[model samples]
Target chain A: MKYTEEHEWLRIDGDVVVVGITEHAAEQLGDVVFVELPEIEAVVAKGDEVCVIESVKAASDILAPVDGEIVEVNEALSDNPGLVNEDPQGDAWFFKMKLDDLRVLDDFMTEDEYKDFLG
Target chain B: MSEHSTELKQTPLHALHLELGAKMVPFAGYSMPVQYPMGVMAEHLHTRAHAGLFDVSHMGQVILTPKHDMAALEAGLEALMPVAVSGLAEGRQRYGMFTNAQGGILDDLMFANRGDHLFMVVNAACKAEDIAHMKAHLADVAQVQPVTDRALLALQGPQAETALAALVPDVRAMRFMDVLSVDTLFGALWISRSGYTGEDGFEISVPATTVVDFARLLLDRPEVAAIGLGARDSLRLEAGLCLYGHDIDTGTSPVQAGLVWGIQKSRRTGGAREGGFPGADCILAELADGPAQLRVGLHPQTRAPMREGTEIWDASEGGQKIGCVTSGGFGPSLGAPIAMGYVDSGHASTGTPLWGEVRGKRLPVTVCDLPFRPSTYKR
Candidate 1:
């Protein structure tokens, strides 16, 4: 598992990278009320904003961690946005991306390093 | 986390907010709690179900006493706002606004007739100017004294009576809009049976020194929970209440904001005390002729919140801009997105269909009657 500075966590599953926000980000956002997911098969850059998350307090954006194509998204979030706050790193995974080369993930922080980065 | 963190004012309950793991944010030049550990959603729902305590110490509290007699002070107040200050029966409070000569609202406020004197509560952001405005206009007839040693707390919800009456039994006898001072073990509590939330509640003004203890006593009840600014806003919005600086502002007139109810019949045309206040000509004319724009409730057809500043367009495919949203967000109690904004009078009907542009997409919105949910005031 890897984490980005933008408070997103990525996990490799076969040839896809499952991406979701970190627990820290979810806690900061308070309660999630609405989520606008990106379209499946949409090509995105490393820094592209692909998702919009609205909480009871304010709205936030989820940036694509690395360059890839959005292959799948968590449709469950549309009906139950609270899942993002309930399980941010697991069932709350936003989408899966098909990266051309998975080695690019090596540059991201590991779980231990992400904790230090959060500090 | 603003750059002027050191300059922000702290309420008497600041330390207690921190102890409860509240997320403090800068609001109206004060370091206040935006939410507690329960979060905004839970806090909002909790207030609807039971009772929620809010520390509104940042709002301005002023006492206006007549140097000569109460009648003279009533006239002094009548000259500043459109409300009927003279006929405001003792122990009753009324909503009012300071208006500019052009008929625009300077600030919305609540003033109660406490028999011997008037107790006025103004918004925090406009406190300094509101105080100065009152002194400049009514100094010779009334003594405008700002009360800085008191903290205002709002106990709102269906169970508010159950929670507060347990401590101050006198409050149970008070009806909506009733104002009285009661003595308790804590101190002399100046309380009013009213609040911004559309709920049966009380707004208590307690001495700043003993506010923390009083807040803790209320929170210790099983029916009470500490709410924050975040939920306070959502609750008020759901109740169809206008927030100062939003929904209504210095550029909006009382008539355009649909606040004509605040103006007593005596102040209108052909009344006994007609045309004595500021902007009386424009306000009265608008009241009779009807305003060009009307503030109405907006119900977004989707789950996404259409926040403030979202433009409202006619329902046509390529329609002209008619208005802009002033207060918009998710309605926790209703489980959908609700908003209030100004629109052309032609499209202000309760069932009229409109369109609100959000983030580059035009979403369907309907002009619904205010207070998406029915207010449960103890009338």
Candidate 2:
């Protein structure tokens, strides 16, 4: 229920949403070879380009799932980018943003729904 | 993406790689692991600072034997290459290239004289064609046997020797470029104290059936970790090593690639050896003067990584197109962007201003001396 078709996941915490890549995206990328994060506190709109994730053979942009301001970034990725490939749903969360559109959650799939969609 | 219908070959460690969650991609007609859980940059830094293991089994390995006499085999090999192979010592390795009649390199290869036989390793992309070329030319003098079922693992890093010594004690005494037959925890293996990463390391060749177990044993060592093609590229880039297809191909000559050291002095001077090898006349001439275009290292000013096929412009020549970048990326160890490209000899000096045209925008760059990181081979 916290997943998007674009392979992004959102975890609601008060007014902020923590964002990260899904395990499927990580699997498709083969490895979390490199992560190019945006500057902290930068303002981003829904579906806007926020970050880049690169594997050896491919590079993809991580779009913002909801319009918000990036309040914090996972600085650990600068040294341990593989965390995204190892545990994308947990320690690999990209950043935290103050949500501007809670209605976007309705468009995302729940855990069970996402599993069915993947199948 | 282009789909290649060619059947992709797998190494002995293929199953193990998949079990460990390696992402496989087609490279040189083989399914190779490009990266693992650590990613490219981290693996690259680990290989430089610690030790990283790479599966390089796709590369071609061949054993050359004399059909009539050893002299004839040596002469036949020298006829196709520029290195002096006749006087090579047993258990020593020499880097060389096969050239066309016009002096352009056909393929870069490593030649090791192992007493009774001559051993060689070549680029995977050029292996089949290279073997066919040799078979067609030297069938009368030498017999080429392809060792397809073997596996090669490169253990590279600052602590590589220590980690390997714990497994194979005799490997500790092997000098740079020395090849030795040693016994390891797995079994007997052929190990060479040389690598492409410009570090103290060993490249071990083992039976295909036991490769996975051997790799697992190495990984068990606290200092050793599995690395993929991503780190392999960055490591070689920092070391100023050439990747055959990208940096030097059938169209480029060794002299132009700054690899003139591979040509022995004895092979160049003797009256009997004036012009025996393919393209000897053109190669010797270029060695005396210099190639028109030379491969040079570039240090870009911007953080953005310039990629292959990026055009290079001569700043002093009205920004004329002079060459193109062959390889470029961010070097984790060097902490900056580095690239290598062929430029006109006039603009090959260190600190010469050049331009790299990326996406219609020109990025300022400077020519710099190569081997951005000092080579730590135990010479």
Candidate 3:
């Protein structure tokens, strides 16, 4: 698993990449009321805004970690957005995408490195 | 502390906020808590279910003294404000606006008739200007005395009264909009049975020196939690209350902002005090003939929140821009998105279908009755 300064987290699962936001991002947003994910089969570039999470406070964008085409999104988020706040790194995974360039994964920081970067 | 932190003003509860792990954000020149660790949603729900304490000391509090010349003082105030402050009965408070010569709002405020004097509280951002304006205009009749030593605290929610009564016994007898001067263990306390969240609550004005201890005592209650501006905003929005800068401003009139209810009948045409306040001609004219636009409640049909600045479209007019959302967010209690904005008069009716354009996507929205949730005010 790796994290980006934009607060997105990505984990490699087979040939696809699992993506969501970091717990720090979830906490900063206060409450996760709604999440608007990119459409499936849509190609996105690294650092592009792929989703938006709206809380009672404000709406924040979640950037894509690597250049890829989205294959699946967490449909449960539509009915239960709190899933992001409850388990931001787990069941709240926003989407899964096929990596267009594997080297793009190296651009993010590892778990320990991300913690240091946050500090 | 950094140089920036030194520049931001701190309230009486500043130390307490840091001690309680509050996330302090700069607001209206003061470093105030935006939320506690429990998060905005939980704090909002807690207030609706029980009670939440807020430090609102940043808001300006002032005492308007007429020196026993009530009639002269009343006239002096009426010159600048739209509402008939002179008609306010003892212990009653009225919402009002200081209007410009053009019928635009200078600021929205609440002033209570204290039998011998008037107590006014204005928004934090507009406090200095409002105070200066009062001093410059009403100096001859009323004295503009700002209260700098007092800290304001709002204990709001359904359980507010019960939880508050435990600390101050006399609070139980006070009804909505009732103001009382009570004595507590800390010191003298002035409490008003009113708040912005449309909940049954009390606003306690205490000596700044003892505010932390006084607030701490309330937080010790099972039903009470320390809420911040995050929930304060959401609660007010769900209650259909207008935020000063967002919903109403210097460019909006009371009639257009849907604040005519705040004006007493005496201030209307053919009444005793008619046409006395600033912008009277334009305001009174609008009263007789409806304004071009009216503020109304809006609910986005989808889960996606339609935030402030989202362009509103009249569904019948081929997606033409009719208005823009002023305040919007997810209503925690309703589990949906809610908003308010000014729209053309004909499109302001409840159940009127409309569309909100967020980003490039047009989401279905509808005009609805304000206060998406029913108010539980003790009144």
Best by TM-score: 1
Q: What's the C-alpha lDDT at position B116 in model 3?
A: 85
Candidate 1 per-residue lDDT over residues B63-181, each given as its tens digit = 99999999999998889899888988999998999998989888999999998999999999889889999999998889999999999999999999999999898899899999989
By TM-score, the better pick of 1 and 2 is 1
Q: Model 3: residues >4 Å from true position, as ranges?
A: B1-6, B316-318
Estimate candidate 1's alpha-carbon lDDT, on a 0 to 1 scale. 0.93
Clashing pairs in 3: none
- Write one digit per residue (lDDT tens) for candidate 2, span B1-379: 1336578989999998888777788898899998887777678888988999999999999889989887898889888998888888999999989999998888999989888888899988888888999999999998999997789999999999988888788888899999998766567798889999989999999989888988898899888889999889988988999999899987888899999888888667564455688888888888888899999999987655567788899763466998889988777787667889899999999999888986566888899999888899998
Per-model i-RMS in Å? 0.7, 4.3, 0.7
B13-103: candidate 3 lDDT, tens digit per residue: 9999999999999898899999999989999999999999999999999999995598888889888887888767888877878999889
For model 3, report DockQ. 0.92
Of candidates 3 and 2, the better by TM-score: 3
For candidate 1, the TM-score is 0.98
Per-residue alpha-carbon lDDT of candidate 1 for residues A3-103, written as tens digits (9 for 90 to 100) = 99999999999999999999999999988989999999999998998999999888899999999999999999999999999999899999999999999
Give per-residue CA lDDT, model 2, range A5-82, as digits (tens): 888899987878889988998877754546778788899987888887755444578999888899999988866777
DockQ of each: 0.88, 0.18, 0.92
Off by over 4 Å in 2: A1-119, B1-5, B183-187, B269-272, B315-318
Superposed model 1: Cα runs more than 4 Å off? B1-6
Question: Alpha-carbon error at B136 in model 3, in Å?
Answer: 1.0
